[model samples]
Each structure stands twice: as C-alpha cells, then as structure tokens.
Target: MTDDTPQTRRPLRVLAAMSGGVDSAVAAARAAEAGHDVTGVHLALSANPQSFRTGARGCCTIEDSRDARRAADVIGIPFYVWDLAERFREDVVEDFVAEYEAGRTPNPCLRCNEKIKFAALLDKALALGFDAVCTGHYAQVILREDGTRELHRASDMAKDQSYVLGVLDERQLAHAMFPLGDTVTTKEEIRAEAERRGLAVAKKPDSHDICFIADGDTQGFLSKRLGRAEGDIVDESGTKVGTHEGAFGFTIGQRKGLRIGTPAADGKPRYVLDISPVTNTVTVGPAAALDVDALTAVKPRWCGTAPSGPGTYTAQLRAHGEETEVSAELVDGALEVTFTTPVRGVAPGQAVVLYQGTRVVGSATIASTRRAVAAV
Candidate 1:
C-alpha cells in the first residue's frame, strides 16, 4: 500500500510463535506479562523431523513441541502445535536448494520469516481473531508519536535479528510484536528471566546454524539432493586451476572446501569470486576480487515508508554483518545500492537490509554485485 504503514491497535490479543528456544519462551512470557491475551503456537515445520534433538532444542522435533507446551503452561496460556511441514518444505527447503542450484547463496531463515512465520502463520492467527503475531526476533516495533510503527534493531547488538525481519511489509508490521526488541535487553537477561519464571527452556541452547540440514554438511546435503555436475574452477584469465563436483555446493567468498590442488602462480590464497550455474563454473581469485562496488536489489519492502528520494543509509550484506554507508536510489523498479567504500561477499539472492540509524527502513533480494574496476 502506497503511503501506508502498520498501525498498532491496543488491547492486544497476541499469538506468539514459539520455537522451543529460550528466547521465544521468554518472549512469550513477556507478551503475557504485558497483560495481553496471549496464546502460544509452535509450528511443526519438518514433515519428518530427524528425531535427533526432539528431546531438546530442535524446533521441528516432538521435544520442541513439548518444550513449547511447557513454556505456555508456565505463562498460563493455551498452547497448540500447527502442522506446517508441507508448506515449510515447499517454501523454505525447496527455495534454498533451488537458489543454490541457480548459483546464488540464499538465507533460509529470512525466507522462513517472510513466507512462513509472518505471512502464513500471521494470516492464520488473524483468521482466528488474534490481533497480533508475537515472536522472539531481536528487533523492535516502535509506535512513533505520529501513529506509525517502525521496526528497529534490537538493543543487544550481538543478537539483533532485524536483518531477517526486513522482508516484513506494512501489513505484516501492523500485526507484529517483538517483546525482545528492547535495546537494553540482552539474551542473558532473557534467559535469567526464564529461570526466574521456572520455565524449562531457560538453559536450553539457542538453535544454531541452518535448521533443516541436520548434520550441517551443506555440500553433502545439496549434492545428494541436487546431484553433482562436474565443473571447472577457473581463474580471472579463464584458465582452469582445478575442477569441482558442482558449483551449487559452493558460495561466494568461500575459502575452505575448495579442493584445488594447484596454487595460483602469485602464491596467495584464493577465494570464490563468482558462480555461474549456466556453465556450472566456479571462479576463484584473490580476496580483493571479492570487493563489491555496487549492487542492484529487486522488489524492496519498506518497514514503514520508503525514503522520498535517494540518500545515504547504513547497509548490511549478511546476517549480523557490519554496517557500511551506502547511497540508494530507485531505478527501473530495482533498488540500486552504491557503497561509498567497497563491501565484500555481497551475495546475490541474500537480502541487503537497509537501516537509517537504528530503524530498519527496508530490504531487497540482491540481484547482482558490481565489482570494483581494480578487480576487473
């Protein structure tokens, strides 16, 4: 909606998406403490969760569902598990594999947040008469004095998760809540509160790495699914240095798992500079070749409203990535982002999140990167 923003309506009826982690458990408790009518809903996202951590922190396992139920009981709220396994496989899993096969690195967490948690789950909660969807995202939804809600970075800079939340639009923001968005709050403090509340997940370890790839072997996982296609590992001159099983298994800026036996004549470590799924080629070069001069992102979503004109904003290329000053302009329906200084590893298909100070303005899927003239 043009000139539109999410408006916060009070007397909250909240549906917290619990993921069986300490952060989410505490976030749900905070929502309840705010005197809102809160219900806990845990998503069963795996069609067949590998029974590994179901007894602990695995979000898709039966233990994860039980842990959520325990947290809801502690908060004195009704808890239910929503079976979204098929949808998760379609939207998140399939998309991840496809993006890699297309020679682009994708963040599945952001996709899950955008398509599943906020869009799919929130839609269900609303149909059930819930006012807002709450979560453990380390980001703030601030209601400005003039009556508009803006998403901001979480107080704990180390744990801020607004980058993944950048896919949210005005409609989603209108019905979203982040109890852990407080800048002064830390994950340690949240866990301590859970202990005080006697919640079982207080000491529960935070889920790490990609959730679905059970053993975290992305290469093995993708090769098994997408199958291997032999390709050449070329240098800047197009001379083959070595060969690879598949370009989809590698990512931009990757150094390890190269398996290149021959070293460049210059005798410096090489890095993945580009991947061409069309030709199934993996290009390697020195680190400076990875320096990105500019980028064009497609289909940006503003958290509140888009900037009236082109201006400088802090941009992050990766989740928890360092911020760099960048100038942005709308060009031919794409967000053209130019950095005052070069940024590294700006992967296409990963979301480039923009922030004006602490407030998250919007983000877009990075379509391509413009390398420096020195690189060429």
Candidate 2:
C-alpha cells in the first residue's frame, strides 16, 4: 500500500470544493499549505438561492456561498462559484422525488456525490487542467504500488463518510483528494485548525438532512413536488386500516405518524413493511415482519477492481448505519448479498456498500429484499 500521507505526494493543481462549512474550509487551507496550487469553488445547487432558507443546516444558500468565498480569501486561493443548480435539480432533486414516488427511499447525498461532484464537477475541473478535485469528505484514497487507487473509511469512524462516497468508480477515485481522511482529530479539532488559519467558517454549523428541503419536512417537500394523491394504508393482509394523503410519504420500517386509529389485534406497534406505488398503498405490520435476510442490487460501482466471485464482507445498508457481515457475489451483472443474520429495515433504492475491513469494495442500489425463512 502507498504511504497514507498527503505530504509525500508531489505538488499539483487541486480544485477544492468549498462547501462553506468548517470541514471544507479547513481542507482547502490544508491543501494550499501543503504547497499545492489550490483553487476553491462552491457549488451553487439551488436555482432560487434567495428562496432557500439561510441558517445552520441549509446548504447551497447565498450565505453559504459568502462563507466559502471568505474562507478562500483567508486561504489566499482564488475562489469561484459554479452554477450547478440545473444539473442538481435534474440529477439529485428529481431523482429523489422519483425514488420516493416509486416506493423507495433514496439518499440524495450519494446521488449528489456520484452525479454532481464526481461526474459533472470533476469532469469540468479536469477539462480546466486541474489534476485533482478535493473535498472535505471523510474518506481516504489509498494508492497501491501498482498505481491503482482504493477508497477507504476515514480514520475517525465517527465522522467516516465512505458510505455516501461508495458510488465513486475507479476512474473517479484516481483524481479525488480527501485531506481530512487520515486525521484522527475530532470535528472540534478541525474547527480549531480553521480558526488558527483565520478561516471565518471555523464555527459554522454543519448542514444536515436534505439540503433541497430547507424546512426538514420530507413529507411536505415530496407532497409539494409530486402533489398529494390520497392512498390507502393497509395491513400486511391487505386490510385497509388508515388513509394517507400520499403513499410516497411512507418508507420501509417507518412506525410513527401512521395515524392508524385501531391498534393491532395483539396490541403491538405496527411498522411499515412495504410500499406499493403502483397500487398506491402502504403496508404496515409487526416489527418482526421487517427483518431482511438477503437482497439483490443493481448498478454496482466498484471503487477499485470488481470482485471476481463470492466474498465475505461487511455491508452497510444506509449512510451512518452499522456494517453487518454478508456474503456477496456478482451474478448476471447484479449484486446478490446474504446477511449472516437478519437485518431490519433494508429498503429498496438505498445503496448497500460493501467493505472488506476499512476499504470500500463497491456499492449497489438495492432492488429487492427477502425475509428470513424463520420470519416468513
């Protein structure tokens, strides 16, 4: 394995994506400090920047742009704002709504990283002669002796973002730089470093939830986009129990806000077991019904080389979720994964990232799931 230090690498032109957060600002500063020719750029992902709320948890806001510009000024690097609102809306926002409408939960962050950051932005940077596109993502790119690259979790597992970044293919990994990956420091330490470097966003609050949905109300956001179509909330046996304005509002394993008037026969709480967009129905059942033992996924993106056959790996079902042991293999251009034990709440359309130790093996979009035989 190549030395896990950025200092040993030769100076090159780096295009740092400054997200107007403490992490990105500090990352840009570190790149410039290491003698790399770094230029900072903030992605304007909102078409109507004025309409988006400006505050701690909002991303791509005008305030965020200003913060990014200020940080670039402090870092002594040229700053620019790239208007990617149209692309973001088409790729990330619309994709999110579509996934929901199809009765699946989607991770917009993963889509943004895949389509906007890596595909669109990275391509543009490379066209402009930049050798690499750097970001504040808490993940590492390990270069092998053979010159191939591998993506891995950050040293600080608490802040590791490799799950969202699992969509990066080998080509994208070649030109990606993550300066914060190897650091064992806490997020507070990163903020302190930014303060020492005179970066104004040192204490800026981190953005969370869906950036496009400024209000943090996902149900409201989807309703506005897709328009409400009243649907039936039914039990697993197809018995209607309640009604919802939109079936898209529900997701697998959701338990609250179901508005079911009558309790279960056994007086147990009911969890969302499935959603059928075609029939416009949401299926709820006992918590035991949510156990998933196996899943099939499509569109696998390998970080390095694709696995040759079946392998024992750890699979992360969602971002910030715990990794569970799984046996995975590629079959007929799809990924089939079987867990060592039943995992709950494995939903379709979510990316399942596979890892062998700390290194990211690949990721695939879950297509379907199967319950354990015992549970069935």
Candidate 3:
C-alpha cells in the first residue's frame, strides 16, 4: 500500500509542481506545514523558454523557473528544474497542432494535465521515491472508507478547476494531492496568504490563454506551424461567402474575422458551424446552426470506477463552460451524452467531462456532436 492511502496519517514525500504562481508556492508551503516532506520542481516545458511569453501571459518561461526557485528557497524546500521539454513538445504542443490540423478544437490544458502533469510528472515522481504529486489546482480529493479516492469540485466554484483535471484516472488520483481545494477564500485571499507567508509572487498575475502562443495570436501560431493554405468559407447553401488563409484558423461558433464578402439575407451574423480539413473548407451559418443537443465522445477516462451503465449527470463542455444536465452511457468505449437542454459552441477534440453533482465522474475527448433538430 502507498503512504498516501486513506487512513495513513504519516508524513508523505510530496513533490510539488511549482509553476512560479502564487497558488503553487502556497500549496507547497501548506504541504510542508502539514508535516509532509515536500520538494519543489518546475517543469521546463519550452525548448527555448526565452521565446515563450513572459510576465502574466506565460506559465513556463525562464522567469517562471527563477520565480519557482525563489519560492522554494523561501519555503526551505529542495528545488529542481526538470527538462521535460521534449515530452511536452511531443505530447502537448505537437498534439495541439495536429488536432487543429485535423479541424478539431483541442484543449491543450486538458491534454497537458492528462499527458504531462498527471502521467509523465506523476510517473517520474513515483520512480524518484515520492509518495504523491501535489499541485495548486482547486479540486478536492475525497478518500472513502475502502481506501479509494474520488475527485470533486473545489469549495469556490468560481475558482474550481476540476473540469481540466477530469482526465485523471483512478491510478493517478491515488497519488495526487490538491492543497488549495477546500479553501473558500477568494483569489485575493489566496494572494494575501502568500503575502503573509512572505512569498514574492504574491502579486504575480495569473497566466491566461495558451502559454506556448506567446503573443496570444492563435491563428498566427497555427499559420506558422501548419503553413497558410488558402481555403474557401461557404454558407449552408454551399455558396462561397469568404476565404481564409487556413481552415484550421476557424473554430466552431466563431463569429468574427470571417471576412465574409456578402451579408446574410436575414442580416443576422453568421457563425462557424463546421470546419472540414479534408476539403480545407469552413462552413458558416446562423447562430441556430451551432446548437448541439447530443455528443459522441471517445477515449473516456473515469476518475474512479467506470460507470456501470447510462446515468444522469452534469456535463461540462469546456474549461470555463457551465455544466448542463446530461444522460451519459458508456458503450463500446465511447461516451454518449444527451444534454437535457441543447448547448452551443461544442467542438470535436474538446473534452466533455461528466459530474455526479460536484464529483468528477470522468471525461472523454469529444469526437462529434449532433445538432439540435429544432435548429435544423
């Protein structure tokens, strides 16, 4: 049995992943204060950290590494920087590009949590004799009487990150620790805690958007990686409305930058309804065309035991998206979910995470969506 097994009150050897942010720094401190033997490690994700964005917009930069080291010093824990640049590039970065190339809207953050943080990092920590991998994610881990663990939402719903972490399976949940999960405090309160703890990153701005996209220009980034292949943008009647440099630049439900030459007959704004990588074409239509009522998701990953059959639950379609009631069934490894009410903006390659109330049941990569018949 692992040292982190339920009912074990012994001091655990915890490896805290410090991202040079206030949350992680304080999480490490709290773990140490709770008598865990904690060590701080920063993942050097970018091959050339200098080229990545800096300050409030970036997560893995040279500045971030330095800040993590300083936080470790202040917390009096052993610190190290692991060069996971190769793994990160292959798993997260390359996958992000490939997904877009396939005309799917992939969430790199969810992929990173599944492929890099929980799988790669947790595996390495275990090999190095660490009992658990701790992070600053605002999600709770519940230990049941049978020594099993469950992942649940954080106390602060606004700050809850269980959606992105729904990819963690049972094995990963066993060795995971979230020190900031139960706190009902606000972001300012967390920062104040960091200030009181004498951490220098107390006022550091939270990183936003895709970290690797340094300038926040996702279209420009993809254009550089995938190269510009001018494609036609057509309406529902198969009439060309506009042209784009690449079909990969458009996502489902995108409204702006379509560069449509003609106005709609109804003059209602059109949205990106579909992107076809095979034909290199983007399809635009009315907002009603974007309504999705059902989804067929692949690669289902359950946090604990897989559900026995179809069950009613709430499903979160995106990172910050609201959860909607859904009836989910696991059939031949795919998750079939039907939302009680139709949802909009759902895209393939994004995850559809199901929840039984506040507990994260599992997540799957959205393979396809069924448009609402009423909208048709």
Top lDDT prediction, candidate number: 3
lDDT of 3: 0.92
Question: What would the TM-scores of all predictions be?
Answer: 0.95, 0.97, 0.97
Tens-digit lDDT track for model 1 on 188-232? 877888999999998888787778877667898899998989999
Residue lDDT tens for model 2, 296-353:
9999999988999899999998898999999999999999999999999889999999
User: How much lDDT does candidate 2 score?
Assistant: 0.91
- Which window of ten consecutive residues has the lowest lDDT sum in model 2? 1-10
For model 1, the stretches where C-alpha displacement exceeds 4 angstroms are: 1-10, 51-58
**Which residue pairs clash within candidate 3?**
none
lDDT by residue (tens digit), candidate 3, 61-153: 999999999999999999999999999999999999999999999999999999999999999999999989999999988888787789999
Which structure is stronger by TM-score: 1 or 2? 2
Q: For model 3, where is the 10-residue window of minimal lDDT?
A: 1-10
True-structure RMSD, every candidate: 3.1, 1.5, 1.8
